[model samples]
Target: MSPPLRIALADDQALVRAGLKALLESFGDLVVAIEAADGAELIAALKATPVDVVLSDIRMAGLAGPEAVRCLRRDGDGTPVILLTTFDDSTLLLEAVEAGAQGFLLKDAAPEDLHDAIVAVARGESLLQPVATDPVRARYAYRDQDAPKANFNEREIAILRLLAGGYSNKEIARSIFLAEGTVKNYVSDILDKLGTRDRTRAVLKAITLRVI
Candidate 1:
């Protein structure tokens, strides 16, 4: 049998944390390895025992969720983080994306959605709440006026088009008969040229610029 998914929970509210823990534990293949009431405790737990995923509230005592994510990423920690927030502010969402968080979920997201996000991030896929995506796209839509047209060659354009079509990196590589690493490089170039931080943002910028 496949090993259970090891998860860590971090929130300032004890009751909320416990509720989330109970909800998550109901899934057969998920295990709550640790729980923290604040970001400091969360960091300590991470240092003491690593887990496959960390679900953290965006607003936490001490470090806050985005800062904690930045610290982990800077330390080269590969464990994915799923940020939970109550606010639908696009600024916070963009900050989370830039911090390398694998998933962004609302505080009221369904338990099943949380479970699926954990599973998806564990497998190196990004999971963003569908309702959040539109606002995020809108935030980048106006940049097209100031940004230059992408300087991509035909191959790069092909890759960006696939990305805009909602294809994952691996799927794009396969469709184009290119190595995954090659596709990743192309994506990096696309992001650089488009002045965006991530795949979703890049696609949105491309659409706004009419480049893809």
Candidate 2:
């Protein structure tokens, strides 16, 4: 069998953190290797000891999940993150994902959803999910395919898949043998075609449209 996946977990309430730790560990092949009460501590602990995935609360007394994720990605840490939230705040949820989280779950999610989300991002696939379908999240994300066909060419489709995998423009350029500037221009066109402002939203729409 493969080694168990290591997870770094962060949440402000000690009791909540402990309960979540237990629940996560109860799932075989997963372990909470690091724990923290807030985002700042989570980031510090991660810098000291990296893990396969990060499961963090979206709002905390310090740094907050979105800001913390922004910091990690800014410093070149590509570790995938799945954020948790109790509130049904679409704005905050979008902020966290846009800041580089691989996915987010409502704090009340069933154990299997949590387990599956962790495994998905750990394997470099976008969860774009939580197995228990959340209605509030449904409001802003993943509607029926309504976009007019983007008619993306083969190259644009390839770039969209890379974006879903969270590749940076430079990384995508290197992978496809194009200049970074050219990749950026293509991304801009993709966003325009999809009517979204950022790559994360673009990918979400692409998935909804089944274009990627």
Q: Compared with the true structure, what per-residue lDDT tens digits does model 1 show for residues 121-158?
A: 88876665544345555666565555555466889778
Model 2, CA-based lDDT: 0.79
Please write out the lDDT profile of model 2 over residues 75-127, one tens digit for every residue.
89999999888875656656776799988777777788788778877876454
Best by TM-score: 1
**Candidate 2 error regions (>4 Å):** 130-147, 150-200, 206-212
Which portions of model 1 miss their true places by more than 4 Å?
131-212
Q: Alpha-carbon error at 51 in model 2, in Å? A: 0.2
Sliding window of 10 residues with minimal summed lDDT for model 2:
128-137
